[model samples]
Target: MPDAVVVEGLSKRYGAVEAVRGVSFTVGHGEIFALLGPNGAGKTTTLEILEGFRTRDAGRVEVLGRDPGDRAEGRALRERIGLVLQDIAVEPYLTVRETIARDAGYYPSPRDVDEVIRLVGLAGQERRKVKALSGGQKRRLDLALGVIGDPSLLFLDEPTTGFDPSARRSAWQNVRDLRDAGTTIVLTTHYMDEAQALADRVAVISDGEIVAEGTPSTIGGRDIARARIRFALPDGCSVAELPVAGLPVDAVPAEAVPGDGLVTVETRKPTEALHELTGWALRHGMVLDRLTVDRPSLEDVYLRLTEHGAPEHNTRRSTR
Candidate 1:
C-alpha cells in the first residue's frame, strides 16, 4: 500500500518571506508522525499544504494515495481524513452528543456516536450544552467531532491544548487506541513530552527548513548525547577534591544563591561515574545532596535544534 502521506522538496513563500523551504518527509500507514517547531518555523505552512488548505510552490505531494491539491477529488479525500485544529467552532447551544452526532452525518461511515463520546472522555457530559462545558471539556469535544467520521487518517494540532494533566493522559490513551486500530495520525504540538510519548517518528522544522527527522528517542542524537550528573557539592568539598575518572566538573550556580557550589559532570558512562561518586561519599561518611543522573530529554534536544545558529541535525530511521 502507498504511504499515508508523502512530501518531497516542498516549498512555500508569502511574498518576500519564504515560509517553507525544501521540507520533505513521509508518514507511513498506521504511524503516529509528529511535526514539531517553534512559532514561525513554517510548521503551519507545511501542514496547510498537506491538508489542501494552501498550495505548495514546489514539491510532489500525496495524501492517502490522492493529490490533496486536486479539487475534483477533494471531497473524496476529505472523507478519508479528519482534522482537529486548535480552534473550537461548535455551536454553543448544541449538546455534546448533538454536536458530535451532527458531524457524523457528514461522513458515509461514522463511528458510533456514544462510542466516540466515551473515547473523548465526554460520556457523562453528553447532554450538557457546549456553552456549559469547561475549557478542557470543549477540547475533548473538538476531538470527538474530528473522529466521528471514522477517518483513515487524522490530523491533530495541539490536541491537548487546554487539557489538565488527567485529561491530557486520557486523551493520549484515546489517540493511541486510534493508531492501534490502523489509523494514521499527523500531530503538531509544542509539548515535547506529548511527542515523546506518542510519536513513532518526528520531524523538527526551523527557519523554514527541516533540520532533523528521527524517532523521539534518537532525534538530534539524544540517545547518544552525554548524560548529565548533578549534585550539590558537600559543604567543605571542592570540585577538584572529588575522585572522578578524569571527568571535568563544572560549577553550576545554584538557584537559591549566586555562588552556591552546585556542580555537574557530563559524561557518557553515567553508571560508572555514579558508582565512583557514591563510593567516595560513603567512604567519607558524607552526603551528596540531590544527586541525579539524567539523559537529554526531548525538550532539551528540541530547544537545541531550534536555537538560532544551531548546527543542522541528521536523521536516523527507526527499524519498523
Candidate 2:
C-alpha cells in the first residue's frame, strides 16, 4: 500500500532558534503513527505543518498524495483530514448532538452523526450542553467533532489528555476502531504507554531532530538493552552460594539490594541466566520470592533517547 504521509528534509525555524531540522519519515496507509517527544521538541511544529496550519521553510511534504503547500489543493485537502486539537473551545450552548451535526455539514462525506457520538463515548451525552460537560467529556466532544467529517486521515493532539484510566482505555479502543475502519492516524502525546499500546511505529524527536524511529519495542535499540532480573532471597540464603552457571561472571552484573534478602542482576542474556538460577533453586528446594524479569520498556528507551547524556550527532539528519 502507498504511504499515507511522506515527509522529506522537513525543516522549520522560529526567529533565531531552529525548531525542526531535516525530519523525514513515512506513515503507512491505515497505520497509527506516533511522534513522541518532550516539550519544545518540535513535535507541535511538525504536526501543524502537516495539518497545513504552519508553513514550512523547506521540504517536500505530501499528505495522502498531493503537496500540502499548494493553497488551492490544501484547502480541499483540509476536508479529507481531521484535526482533534487540544483545548478546543466550542459554543457552550450547543448540545452534544447539535455540535457534531453542525460540523458534519462541512464535509462532502460525513460519518453518521449518531454513530460518531457513540464512537466517541458521547452516546449518553447526546443532549448535554458543552458548558455542562466535565473536562474529560469535553475532550470526548472534541474528538467527535474531529471525526465527524469522515476524513481519511486524523490528527490527534494529546487526544486523551484529560481522560481517567478507564476512559483512556476506552479512548484507545476508539482509536483502534478508527484504524480498523482504514483511517490513517498521526498521534502526538507525552504518554509513552499510550504510544506503546496504540502506535504501530514511533519516531522520537528531541532538540528539533528525530533521534530514533522504529517499532515501539525496538525504538532506540531497546530490544538490545539489558534486562533486569529481580528476586528476593529467603532467610539464610547467601549470594556466594547462588547458582547461576550458564552466564559468564562478568556477563551479568549483580547489584546489592538494600533489604536483607534481595538480589538484582542486569544482564544482556536474561533467559539463560534465569534458567540456570531457577533450576539451581529447584534442585536445592529453595523457593524464589518475587522473581521478576523486566525488559527495557518504551519509556526507558524514550528517556535514554531524549536524555542529555545521549551521544551527539554532528551531522544533520538528512540523506538528501
Candidate 3:
C-alpha cells in the first residue's frame, strides 16, 4: 500500500515571511511518525497544510492517497482522518457520552462511543458534563472524540499536555493499540521522551526545514556518539590509579579526573571500557557506587539540531 502521507518540496508563506521551506517526508501505513520542532519553526504550518485546514504556497502533498489541497476531495479526505488538537471546544453542558456520540454521527463507519470512552480511560465518567471534568480528563475526552470516527489516520498534537504521568502512560498505550490495529499516527510534541518512546521514526524541523530524520535511537548520530560511564570514586584511589591502558587511548582522557567523589569515563566503546573498569575494581576489592552509563539523549540531539541558524545540511531523511 502507498504511504499514509507524503509531502515533497512542501512550502508555505504568510505575508512576506516563508513559514515552511521545501519540507519533505513520508509516513508509512500503520507507523507512528513524529514531527518535532520549536515554536514558530513551521511545524504547525506544515501540519495545517496536511490537515486541509490551510493551503500550501507550493509543493506536492498527499494524505491517505488524496490531495488535502483539493477542495472537491476535502470531505472525503477528512472522513478518513482523526485529529486531537490543542484547543477544541465541546459544549459545556453536554455529558461526555453525548459529546462523543454527537461526533460519531459525522463519520460513515464510527466506532462505538462507549468503546472509545473506555479506550481513552473515560469509562466511568460517561455521565459527567464536559465542564465538570478535570483538565486531564477533558484531554481524554478529546482523544475519545478524535478516535470515535474509527479513522485510518490520526493526528495527535500534544495529546497528553494536561495528563499526569500515570495518565500519560495510559494514553501512550492507547496510541500503540491503535497502530497495532492498523491506524497510522502523526504525532507532534515538545516532549522528547514521548517522541522517543512512541515514534517509529521522527523528523526534526528547524527554521522551516527538516534538519534530521531517523529512528529515535539513531537520530542525530546518537547511536554512535560517545558514551559516558560514571560512578563514585573508590576510596584510597586517585584518578591516575584506574586502569586505562586497554581503553581507546585517543577518546579516553589521559587523566581520569574525579569531581565531587565521582569519576566519569567518556568513550566510544562503552561495553569494552565498562568491562575493563569493573573487572579492575573487582580485582582491587573496590566498590563503585552509583554507577551509570548514558549516551546522548533525544533531548540532547534535539537542542543541538534546533539551535538558531543551525545549518540544515545535516538532514537525514529516512530510507526505510
All candidates: TM-score: 0.91, 0.90, 0.91
Lowest lDDT sum, 10 consecutive residues, model 1, at 311-320
Candidate achieving higher TM-score, 1 or 2 = 1
Best by TM-score: 1
lDDT of 1 by residue, 139-222 (tens): 898889889999999999999998889989999999999999999999999999999999999999998989999999999999
Q: What is the C-alpha lDDT of each candidate?
A: 0.86, 0.85, 0.89
Clashes of 1: 0
- In the predicted model 3, the residue pairs found to clash are none
Q: Rank the candidates by lDDT, best first.
A: 3, 1, 2
RMSD of each predicted structure: 5.7, 5.1, 5.0
The regions of model 1 sitting more than 4 angstroms off are 245-261, 309-320
The deviation in Å at residue 233 for candidate 1 is 1.7
lDDT of 2 by residue, 93-206 (tens): 999999899889889999999999889998898999999999999999989988999989999989998899999999999999999999999998889899999999999999
Per-residue CA lDDT of model 3 for 209-302, tens digit only, reads 9999999999999998999888887877888888878666644543444346667788988888889889999999998989989998999999
